[model samples]
Target: MRIRTAGVVAVLGLALAASGCGDNSKDEPAAKDSPKAASGKLVIWADDKRAAALKPFGEKFGQENGVTVEVQAVSKDLQTNFVTASQQGSGPDVVVGAHDWIGNLVQNGAIDPVQLAAEQKSAFNETAVKAVTFNGQVYGVPYATENIALIRNTELAPEAPKTIEDLVASGKKLKAEKKASEILCLQSGQNGDAYHIYPLYTSAGGYLFGTAANGDYDPKDLGVGKPESIAAFQKIAKLGEKGDGALKRSITGENSIATFTGKKCAYLVSGPWAIADAKKAGIKYDISPVPGFAGGKEAQPFVGVQSFYVAAKGKNKALAQEFVTNYVTKPDLAVALYNAEPRPPALTAAFDQVKGTDPDLAKFSEAGKNGQVLPAIPAMAAIWDPFGKAEAAVIGGADPTKTVTAAGKTISGQIK
Candidate 1:
């Protein structure tokens, strides 16, 4: 899929600033509403794409609710701007973003919990809704859900492969015959994409953290270095018999979408974002389940939930809540948003509404039915750097068990 360059750059900047040093102590307390304060205006911070799609809706909501809705398109640094603005007592009343940002946002005390009506709660995928729920409180109203699925060039592989062995064998033959460049292409940048790689790990009976009695992730049970995880990595490392090693992030070049659409790869682990470009390239493609590894369970990727969150500190909490709960939650708007971006809908009605028209989305929805939500706990922040390095080491020919074990230990130690 085509990368939203501006969004990526903005998110990267926020991620960098959030990951590095920051003045947490300087954050201002959330403004408390006095009994007399007016609540006639609501400000919203949204990405350019979402802003363009939702601006009219926002205006309509404002008119219906007798409130002025100010929708600002903040291309990047959402978390940074939200945090900094909240601290300065000048931030939007609501923001649209991924659930993964919960930990950082909560740490900065930049957002508040959202209380959904029973009917509203029932409308969303339970797992998607739960991703934004932290420490026993719901924090966001989910709009969409996304997950990685195994995508193959339909013309090359008319039928989907059922197992890892089947994929490997077919990919090998195609490469040998000069019909394809690589068997599969997965993301492997400076920080290996744990989110994207989760399917392989789960296919081998591996997980990043264990679940508690309540089904929330248990921070103490970090599983990055488990034997199963190692085995999964080992299998992935063996895929592209390139003497060099498993896929490297640097080799992926500037655009991964180009790599797949260019017909250099037969199978790619991607999401809806790539569908538009694949259509542009005139490549016949379809999605399928990720292959299971070593006789383990089916591969399940991390399901990412995108939602709207009202800042606890927002100047227009009442108006923001009314817009989200009353207007944005409707099936029509949800369908519109899903159509614009083409990801599975978190809203159940929206899912049923758009499934027939968008085959790619249907494929993703089916593939992710058994998927797990990526961990949103604060400890998860520690997994990226060291875990990626260990995966790199294994791909670089280091001992699988040792590399993963060391990485796991380092990750466990780093988490507070």
Candidate 2:
């Protein structure tokens, strides 16, 4: 449950490294000509965290299908290694990863579109399905979802704020009364986190990319330089250093959860991943949707999905499809995965089974019902650094207009 923002470099660097692996030849039939289900064995790759959880299921599936199943833990550089190995025709039949990797994996010819029945697709959360869909094709079978919401200390702030303005007012009062040392525990750091700050940014009327006719992000219609974005920054500047001082470069991913759990802040904009620390600290807390600016759009966090993709160059294509499309969709498997890593389950039946006992899942899912799926387009690789720097600079008292405009220009030039 590491912060997604901190791993941007490693993820993007791996993607860059993948470009040097040379594209898979469209004419080559190495994998396509392989013995489909006749291989008598199926291999799956997963990170260390989930590999153990998958082993028993793999064994069961293998026994049922009359084949040997292996779930290998490719902990280091899983995605990068998957791609490189895939290109050499020696990768696993299935690989587990984030939905955001769909575009790069598809572009590299490392994974294939998953075929799920219409009823099967309807069994999962709509947002989860959308996150795994790229260019009208579903590339993965989603299992769990994560999104940031407003986690408030109930002892410090008994009621949820109706708007960002109300939250700020309450935070200021808490600071004045010496109940808290910070306003909001949204992580900014020296290098700003677009992920943590995104809900507020959207509420202030900013967007990353405009939607195309297909309802997918249109890289050509960059939103950063537009008029609405500038207007959004004008609102954001009011929450920066010279203003209400809620957002700060001093607060970071490393400390924001700790600050909240330590009762140093009343409100924390974070995901379910932070719940463990809060519980360990023995704090009375409640979760809610991040409030919007009084008159602006509803706050929308990016919905990230964890999924299983069938590798295109797999040795056992039929077995891979069977495991991913059928076995992984079971409620028991989804619940088991959730137990291993406590994110909300993407499967509706599994979530229903668990929500009665764990009400927090319902709250987090409610907060993200309107959230946009984290865009998986390859152009998104160009966004992180410039955009984060501009945000960090603005929060540190730099001119919002000049800084944001420059960032937009730099990003546009980099999006190929």
Candidate 3:
């Protein structure tokens, strides 16, 4: 992916809904194309918005297949509930959720590998496909991709900063001029947010896990507690409360976008989901890559893919496979989903059509060119809380080296 030289003129809005928890351990079973009658009922579960968007498509598909299609809206705990219901042999044939849930879904035998032809697989964003793949098998059909970018108010800071140092300098100037109340709106709450802070962490040379030869994260090769991670934390300390005072526990995920939309800050490190509020606030803004450290590596955010999975133990496996493998791959369906939620389409064809109207999709895609796919390995569950708390402590003035080292140990223990 290349970062194109594009100016953000008309901004588009997006909202990334709830991402739930799941993990994978054993190899997922392959989806077999069983020859069966298509007249049976096909039930699908999704969050409210997606359910609403899919109803029309589902009805059309049902009519074409001579079947009944029910798109149920599970407002809360969709992933956990799907898992529980699948285990009891009572879940829907299809479930829409984040790709990160592939691990646990596979581990619990709640979802099956989604069979896609080579051309179909290649039709979507490469990173989106990679996110839904587990143990070398594609497990879901991805619809949208999301990652954080540097969203700056053009009215407050006309030019995009090249690096973290440059951003800090510009923000400091804005604050000193009494034009802005805060320097940056990157969130680091009391418990920390590893997801939102990942760009900065990587820019400072910190890594979560080492990758294997297959390009999969190696759970055994934890990068925390290492010399490089210690060095990275030390660098981050300079931006903490004890240093530049830019990162604050008060700036949370719930409020970071508001801070920027409210014009209290010049810059916000956020994803496409925040764009809706930003557009509503009527701020003249532009999107760019989250700048890296002065001499460090490029800042890489976590790329999250939203996907649809086939329940492993659903009553209508044949119908489910037909819907997920064939019906869901259509560019029109992808375009419709985008219209419902306005995320960057994972399908290349759909994205191509949408980019002409929603140029912010192109800008966001450029911003996340160097992004790392959010890991879906079961071991990843162990890294969140411990790592987040350690990050919070360091941001609140704890010893960077000691605190990070302890976090690494805690994560290691949990993984073990």
Best by TM-score: 3
What tens digits encode model 3's per-residue C-alpha lDDT throughout 1-416? 11121111121121211221112213432233332433367788988888878988887766665566788888888888999899888788899999989888999999988867776777889999999989999999999998889999999999999999999999999999999999999998889999988888999899999999999999999998988888888888899899897888889988889999999999999988888999999999999999999999999999999999989988888678878877788889999999988889999999999999997898899989789999999899998898889888998999988999999999999999
Q: Work out the TM-score per prediction.
A: 0.87, 0.90, 0.91
lDDT of 1 by residue, 1-416 (tens): 11132211111111101111112222321112211116566688888788767767776655444455677788778878888888888888888998988887898898887656655677788888888898888888898998888888888778888887787778778888998776667776655667667787778677789999998899998887887777776776664233323355543424566778889777778888888989999999989988776577888888889989888788877556656665667788888787668888888999898888777778888888899987778888899788777766665566778878899889988995
Model 1 TM: 0.87
Q: What lDDT score goes with residue 248 in model 2?
A: 87
Candidate 2 least-lDDT 10 residues: 8-17
lDDT of 2 by residue, 140-233 (tens): 9999999999999999999999999999999999999999999999999998988888888898889999899989999998888677777787
Off by over 4 Å in 1: 1-39, 240-253
Give stretches of model 3 more than 4 Å off.
1-39
Using alpha carbons, what is the TM-score of model 2?
Answer: 0.90
Span of 10 residues, lowest total lDDT, candidate 3: 1-10
By lDDT, highest first, what's the ranking? 3, 2, 1
TM-score of 3: 0.91
Query: Candidate 3, clashing residue pairs?
Result: 22-104, 23-103, 23-104, 24-103, 24-104
